[model samples]
Target chain A: MAAIMAKPSLKTLKCTQCGGAIELRGGHNVRSIVCQYCGSCLDSKDQFKLIHKFLNQKRPFMPLKIGASGKLKGILFTVIGVLQYEEREAGEFFRWLEYLLFSPTHGYVWLCFEDGHWVMMHEVKDLPETQVEIVSPRKTRFKARDKTFKVFENAQAHISYVEGELTWQAKQNEKILYLDAVCPPYMYSIEMRGSEQEFFWGEYISVKDINAGFRIESFEPATVFSCQPFVVSPLFEALSKGALIASVITLVMYFLISSSGTPVMQHHFGNQLFADGETSKEFKVDKPGSLYGITVHTPNLKNAWSFFDVRVVDRDETNKLFTMPTTLSFYDGYEDGEYWSEGDTEVVSYFRIPEAGEFKLAVDGEGGTGEEPAEGFSLSGVNVSIREGVRLGHYTLTWFVLCLLAAAPYFVKYMLFEQSRWHDDEEDDD
Target chain B: MAVMLTCPSCGNQITQITRSPQVLVCPACNTTSFLQNGRLEDVGKSAILTDIPSIFQINRTYRHKDWKFSPVGRVRYDYGDGWWDEWYVRGENGKESWVSVDEGEIAIEVLVQEGLNVPPFEKLSVGGVLMINRQRMTIIEKNRCTMIGAQGELPFKVIPNETYDYVDLLGPKRSSFTIEYQAGGVECYKGVWVDPFEIAEA
Candidate 1:
């Protein structure tokens, strides 16, 4: 689809209308030349005959003048002409520019710039695909990359300025209604005049790349395009893949470490009571292990929660080294107005011991309506179960959390893709 | 090359000579002769045109697509605000084709014959597709520019400034298409984008 262009040659032709010095530098193949002085369009083959008189407007971005050379896809090209276009809707005026590029070998291409973003496009001989579904009253559906893109912009674009040689009869003030279907950096455009339509396809070019092609060192695009894939895009992709891989790795590690958990104890201390400040039970550890598990169960409280403050401590260590107290609450609430509840009436806690020793499983003495738990709410039949092993449930829960975090990058990617669809287009539900 | 013919207006033998000059000036009577139907028909008085800078010179051959084209003649059109060039190129096979360079694009063009039916500009639209020679193509741009004048040699007749309407179509591969509405009803043309580098001296 791409090839080298013809070598450029310069021949001087004076403008017939203005006698202004005119230069035709694209190649002898150039058909038309515009005068810089008197603004005359003339045939490049012979003496300049007045095709039309034109008043040149200032080139929009003057640095990109005619005859400027650049490389696209590593192929050299010369800017043979520049045309500026403007349009208006809803009392707001929008403008852009298209630079005609000539590749003596490849023939011709166009560089379009709007709000500082540039797109290199050419007439596509092959149409991508079309859809039968009508997107809007005035627009149709186009297919690209297995996705359907709706016509987002359809407006009349007018020529604003022109300079250098053109292959077609390009005149300022000529306007054509063009429809655009955009999928981020790539856009499919159609220009309709009368009964004929033309198709052109293009991709967004970063300012950095454009500058490098044109060899412009001091340059920055007017506005950074939102659809312009960020340099960190690849980084996000790498991280997303890494996150998924890490999630799986973490899950496997979770299962492996959790497999080492051996149930050291599962004794349920049942119907325990504390008449004093705190009633405690002593469990002697024959061997110490990596982790501890505590499960407390209470009698169903109809629709109430019973709270118990429990602690595990090594009696051998006077400093109460393992005396970490934790609150265990049990609830068995019935479905009620304004809210519904369904949960187990049991809770769990864990403690780790450094060495084998005698440890005390202690429960606080009841104070709030302490006797018989004041009727409806009670902790009298409360049972406490303890186990010593690696905490498998902790690893499983942690693995799930890590997986959720890992999925975040993909969501971000999706949102960014959606945002790019609307970046240069006016909002439309269609 | 100058073609000798009798001026119908001045009734004088005149010579229309120039390198592919489409509109020839009869030096004997100042009669403007246009090449039409294998004859130089006098249209009006001739206007002396100034020479302007062009990339290609006469007698120089350049390559475009599979054809080697040496620009022989050219026409310029004015669309009110600006003007562009359309060149007549003679190929190695002795086939004549038009290549238009406008706003920096080069397209190989040919005259569409008469009697071809074309929808009105109001009815057709951009992003719309049309069937040509049984192949589907997309319409990208519609143009309306008036022919102002021409120079050098040409295959068809030309008026100094005749306005016409047309549309640009694109094929699937890399072909350029154009349909023009002129006095001859409709004309269809197929063209392809050409690069200078790909084109070489023939």
Candidate 2:
């Protein structure tokens, strides 16, 4: 309905049908005005010409009457009209109320009341015609908004009652068809009339906000609308946002701290040749630790893989046992017109060593073949290099898993919100 | 614009195509008369039109979904509450259709030709659905409406105060079908709903 901002006129006209006093608090622009006493639809433009004498006053529940003033967005607006609409689906009737509010400066806007939730809306004149029904391929776009909206409710609604001044001739029980899409706190609606279509942009308002805006003592509806913005639980939104930021900060910290790590000790066994099950001289460790990385480099191995199973025993009186298994494989061969090579000749294993001390190194080789002794490809004969330090990969992997665990809840929450909005158009796959 | 006729009472002449049994309220003197057999028979009636704000008016040019239309006539239906206006229009491709506007909704209706087998009116229920012409359409409402007024060229005569019962059905892609039951015959109309804002911008 098109309404304009006009200065308030003190002129009050008697309803031609009922002689009831009528005031133009909505402004001179309102075309149809209903007599509050007799419920006569009058043509406000043409001397309050009687349009229809409405009977069957099964009035829908409305807490406020026409001409009630409310302040919206700090602007004072007077209620000009009220309309009750009901949509029937699946053997049930869903009803909602709409109040037409007029600010002498802001013209007219609608305050929709349904399921105890309120939405304020204004007429929208243009939208891509192609967006008739949820834009099929693109589910979330409404007009020019960056967020995509899901279908809130799509049903045919009918006007059940009208009161006071309205932009159009107020109907008693006229049918209206509309499709509502929500990006919550915002809703985009397309209404269909005979051959004319209209658009409305709606914003979800809290009951508290409504009461404050209207300066009402309280407005507490018994039931909540299924499409209420907070139905998804705002707690989930806060949790997801907070967790996402925390994960990013933790990731940065992990990268910085992990990169600055240095090896605590290093050992070279290049000069000493060792055989299988051979134990080397004890390397004294100045510090005792929980976990250490045992790195071994067996140089120049070919055509096979070599694995060493190691046992770590503390040299102290109480020799607690800790063991780690490492693999070093280097394979090169030519067959079937293609040359293939695989497996690194060096490997590292990180494990707990009870406590650091005089740690002895043992070399046990298995499954090494097809190479000369000089090439160091045979088992039981290769150099070993050991580095005992904080394992960056181990701690980094632990933090990465922790990050994933933290993100899982947020991901599920996003899907749940989408599920609630998509409840109408889609059946849950689950 | 079609055939020109003189208002029997006021002698005002205007181009119009009157359906066989409709009353014409003289655009000049507001004299209402029944047009029967190429002659105006005085019925002595007039209507005080509630000013309806609409961009799609009589003889106005507009485009809807690739088809250009020129509104020729209108028939307003009174369903006890308010008026529902169905504008008789012709497409650029020479197809005659009805465009209805009530509240802010805009939908076009094209008369379904032969070959559709629809059940009797009594068999249709508000919540019941049926497959018509291979499209699944759900019945929304069934109403009995009377002719309130009309203007200009029309395909069917605007019988003064004639009542008809119709059922409204909705289908996929915003397509809706109307099953109108009349005394002599039944007329079936189907069309897709459109957004007025989409076309207003176009």
Interface RMSD of each: 13.4, 11.1
Best by lDDT: 2
- Candidate 1, residues B10-104: lDDT per residue as tens digits? 67665443334456444446456776655677777533332443445444788655677787666677655455678877777767788886544
DockQ of each: 0.07, 0.01
lDDT of 1 by residue, A1-430 (tens): 1111233346665567765666565644567776655556787655557678667566465658777888986767888877778899889998887888876445577898777788887765435566522224333566854556556667787877777788666676877877777666777777775555666767778778888899876356644453354445777777777877777787777776673345444444333443432434566566566667777666543444455666565564344554444433333334554555555567766667767877776565342323244433335566666666645656665875687597786867666766664554434644
Q: Which portions of model 1 miss their true places by more than 4 Å?
A: A1-9, A27-31, A43-47, A55-59, A132-142, A145-152, A233-240, A248-294, A298-326, A329-346, A351-430, B1-202
Write candidate 2's Cα lDDT for A1-430 as tens digits. Answer: 1111123345688889878888877644578987778889998767677889777756777766777887766657788888888888889998888999876444568899886778888775435334546323324444433456655666678887777888887566777778777666777787876555667777877778778877665566664343456444678767666666666766776776553224554444432233435565565555466446666777666766666666665554245365577766688778898998888877767655545468666555555463422334344346554554453644655665676677778677656765665654466344
For the predicted complex of model 2, DockQ is 0.01
- The candidate that wins on DockQ is 1
Classify candidate 1 by CAPRI docking class: incorrect
Question: Candidate 1 i-RMS (Å)?
Answer: 13.4
Model 2 lDDT per residue over B32-58, tens place: 666777777666644444453455666
Steric collisions counted per model: 71, 17
Q: Which CAPRI level is candidate 2?
A: incorrect
Q: Give the TM-score of candidate 2.
A: 0.48
Q: In angstroms, what RMSD does candidate 2 have relative to the true structure?
A: 16.7
Per-model TM-score, in order, reads 0.54, 0.48
